[model samples]
Target chain A: MPLVNRVKELRARHHLTQGDLAAKVGVTRQTIISLEKGSYTPSLMLAMQIARVFEEPVEFIFTIEEETE
Target chain B: MKRVIIQSLSSIILYILMAFTIASFASTVTHSLAALKSGVFVLEFNFLPFLLLIIFFVVWTIYSFRTRPNQQMGFGQWSVRMTEFSEVDEREALITAKATKAAYVSFSISVPLFMLTFFFYPLFQTAWPTYPVFALVSTLIIANLVYMTTWIRAYTR
Candidate 1:
């Protein structure tokens, strides 16, 4: 993925399991695991949902991680 | 909780039922050893074997009903763990087309074998053959054509 997110850190902060986060975002727990592992990208709605769960703006939670030249 | 419990109950019951059926079949085969080798495989159809089989099945089913899981499953319960399986893009379409071509070649190669079977069956028997031979022949033809067509179509846009 080209973007980085504070999903794991935020989840830790809230003491939430991936299952809990997945439930909050209306997705399967595997989806949450995949997101944290950078093995799969979330849809726009899922991204919004994740932001809502962390109580942060989308930009605050996720940002493009540009490669160094 | 209810849904998970139900699913586990059903699965366990099914497994138990399967085991009971196997055990009953084994007992019947043991009792009918003399009959089994002498003729076409027919069970003695005796009451003891039948009752034993039924009892075994029922016992397992009742056991499953009592022992099923009551806990909730995690999210991975429904989703496949492997990511490499089942491609989701245009490359998959191309691979599908290649497989279809292979299926067509296999079918075409098999047609002569079916025809040969029909050509040879008549030499063995003076009388008309049974419906099973004709049914088998036609099914082979139909299956090949269907497989070829479907496999070929999967590649097209």
Candidate 2:
């Protein structure tokens, strides 16, 4: 994924388990893990839902990585 | 839990009935072929097996229709509801799509190989009359299995 995310850090800050965060966001725990691992990108709605769960802007949690090239 | 059990039971029954029907038909065909070879062209038509097959089909159809998801309780509706309830979220969906793509690529490669085998059967003498059909079915089954296993493992991790 070209986008970087601090989902793990933010989730840790909120003291929420992956399952808990997933439940809050109305998704599966595997989705939360994938988000943290950067193996999968969330849809706009999912991104907004995750951001809402963390009480932060979507940009705060996810950012586009600078292209080294 | 009860619903799950019932759904599982119905699926099992349906598959069992299908297998039984197929086996019976195959055996009947074999018997007919043997009789033809012996100069006895008499063909026996067993009504009981056909009747049983029809009854099973009707029962299964009704069961499936009754379980469907929606305001009305039907098998199709129930299955739809179950699928929606168990469907992977977006992340797993992405993984599943990738796995499916991989399976399709594998299938594409296999198709040419199957065609070659079919065309070269006379030269190689390795292709039995039914080999091509069985090979095609096997390829499809393997591809689906690969996709399912890959996605399931990815999602679980």
Candidate 3:
């Protein structure tokens, strides 16, 4: 299974640049970029912070896709 | 900015001192090795290199502590922050890890092949010195280069 995220979509909806969101969340822009790209998974604290920034639940931001046999 | 400049200068000085110390030690080691090869037992002890290494470490510690992101941050946290700022971020770290794994896999496969080739070298009338130290160092360098290149490409593309 792979994790998918709506970080890029949410950022666009909020009219926020990756750098803007990253600054608001006290992280580097590259971390946001990685989140959007689904290359790195954020910690629980980071996920909650990001969710707060977007005013959404963590589940709304990230989801896991089950592998098909 | 001023502090950064001072830190940079100090770092440069420490680096130069370390380099000089290493060079001197290398020369001494080479001389000793040559002497040993010529059936001469000449052992000399020099503590300059060790002292320089300690000084270099002290300089690094001072610089790291001075440039730490916050007073509340512990040394480990400060070190992580410094590395994150100077080196890769999350994405690059992930890519680097993958690249390193791939490099290790290739290295494992290649080493035995290389050894087998060396084993067959005498049959081919080829004379080569099987220096394990040199071979190991070169392998490590090549593996690191491969990992770096792969990591960079993965991120850039």
Candidate 4:
């Protein structure tokens, strides 16, 4: 199952650049790009870090993508 | 990613140089042995080129393995030390794992193919005693190339 995330949306809402979030989350900017594009999945620690950055819970930021088929 | 590219290119050059150095050293030893068997006691080997090649190869190896000065790497952190598996971040680590898997797969397939060539060794023994050395070096070269290609593709994608 694909992992759906609202990283881009939340990042925009918070006025955080990709680099900013990556630094805040202790990841490379490329990782943020991948996460935003739904091409990469984060580890639980990374998920928690990102969630902490946005002052939100992990579930609010990420969800298991439902199958449309 | 840039560092990975540089490391890959440097590794390629290092392997090539290593091949040349090994071949040259082998040739020198073989010729010296042949001359000794012939009772030609007057040894006239020009060691300058061979020595220079060895020196250069050693220097290049050191340079290729050295990490960036600003990069704080722990000695016990094998993942961080591994050029193919740069674990500076979790995502990079994941990409490195993928690349390492690709390299391992390539190596697993290539080793048997290379070993198959050993069957022909009897035919080339006298003609090319250094075949095994070259084969080993080529295997490393191929693995490095595979790893680099996979890493670049994954990272870019």
Candidate 5:
């Protein structure tokens, strides 16, 4: 199940790498890698903060796909 | 690697101490007069513990050298400098649960085998299975504990 996220795109829009996003989000680059790799799902608070980082809604930044059910 | 080194050194020291204690006890357990009756008692001290200790040291040395520590943070690619950890997230916890479940399953499986060895095989040897059985069961338990702690540390950090 894909935990679809605008993380990469949003970060790209803001000219940020995974490391930059990770520093802003208070986590490790590997965490960003895990998030991007769909190996781990971020906490709601982290998701919300990630959305805030990109100046987007939580839904806009991260959306659950069908298989997540 | 540091943790593994520390654990190896400590377990080595402990095994040496145990070996020494076991050997010393054989001579000291009986009176000096009783020792004389069992002619050559003091002189015929068994070198079993010394032999076992040497074997353990060699095997452990090889095993320790072969076993790599699993610290992933040393790669220097991480973004955050995590200094504290108080809890784990659900996902990591689930992974920990999986490992712990494996240990529990392994432990449960050990019980029957333990009974077989303790009772059924008391007077006989069964392919030298006891040591391997003990090693495997204990290693599983220890690995599960490591997994659970690492999982907890992962997110709480």
Candidate 6:
């Protein structure tokens, strides 16, 4: 199952730019971009950091999608 | 990103320059020794390559240290950083690890290829005395190029 994330949507809801979110989580903007593009799965620490920044639960921000194929 | 690219290119140039410097220095000393043994007593030497090598080494060292990630030396002290070895974040660290593996693979593939070229060394010994020197240098150059290419590709992709 692929890990799906609401990083982009949550970041927008929180009125934060990619750079702003990355700054809060101590990662590069590229990492944030990759995360939003669904090309990278954040580590547990990073996922927690993102959830903390967005004031959401880690489970709410990230979930495993059911495999369809 | 631009800085990283420039750093890779500069390192390639530095490796090539080092090869030329070593080859020239070795050739000069060998020829001088041969001439002296044969009672010719000639001291023909060229300092241009050596001087250029020194100048470029200094410049590259300064540029590398300035642009590369600084590793904390403890208690507010810092020193020179090795590229692809010290990174600022997890993604960068992962990329460096991949690049390092690429370099190792290239080195493994290149050494045997260079060694194979050694069989032909005897044929070109008189005509190209510096063939082995170049072959050795080329191995290092190829490994570095592969590492840089892998790193750049990972970053872009």
lDDT of 4 by residue, A34-53 (tens): 99999998999999999999
Local distance difference test, each candidate: 0.55, 0.66, 0.66, 0.81, 0.57, 0.79
Candidate 5's residue-wise lDDT over B1-157, tens digit each? 2332354344545445454645455445444457779775554455666676677767655554443233353434322321111113334434445545654665666655656656645455434333433444444445444544554454344
In order of DockQ, best first, we have 4, 6, 2, 5, 3, 1
Task: Compute fnat per model.
Answer: 0.00, 0.58, 0.25, 0.67, 0.08, 0.25
Question: Tens digits of per-residue lDDT for model 4 on B42-144?
Answer: 4445565567666866775455446553346444552345454566788888888999898899999889999999999999999888888889988888889
Worst 10 residues of 2 chain B by lDDT: B79-88
lDDT of 2 at B103: 70
Worst 10 residues of 6 chain B by lDDT: B71-80
B23-60 per-residue lDDT for model 2 (tens digits): 45655676789899998876665556567767876876
lDDT string, candidate 2, A1-69, tens digits: 288898999989999999999999888886888788887778999999988988999998888887322
The candidates' interface RMSDs, in order, read 10.0, 2.1, 3.8, 0.7, 5.9, 1.0
Report the error of model 6 at residue B102, Å.
1.1
* Model 3: DockQ vs. true structure: 0.25
Q: Quote the positional error of residue B5 for candidate 2 in Å.
A: 19
| Per-candidate total of colliding backbone pairs | 0, 15, 0, 0, 1, 0
Candidate 6 lDDT over residue span B4-35, tens digit each: 56766777777788778888888888898999
DockQ of every candidate: 0.06, 0.46, 0.25, 0.80, 0.28, 0.62
Q: How accurate is candidate 4 locally (lDDT)?
A: 0.81
The ten-residue window of minimal lDDT in model 5 chain B covers B78-87
Tell me how far the alpha carbon of residue B82 in candidate 1 is from the true structure, in angstroms, after superposition: 21
- lDDT of candidate 1 vs native? 0.55
C-alpha lDDT of residue B96 in model 2? 56
Off by over 4 Å in 5: A67-69, B1-94, B125-157
Q: Write the per-residue lDDT of candidate 3 for residues A1-69, one digit (tens) a residue.
A: 778888899999999999899888877786787678787787788889889999999998878866222
State residue B107's C-alpha deviation in candidate 1, in Å.
13
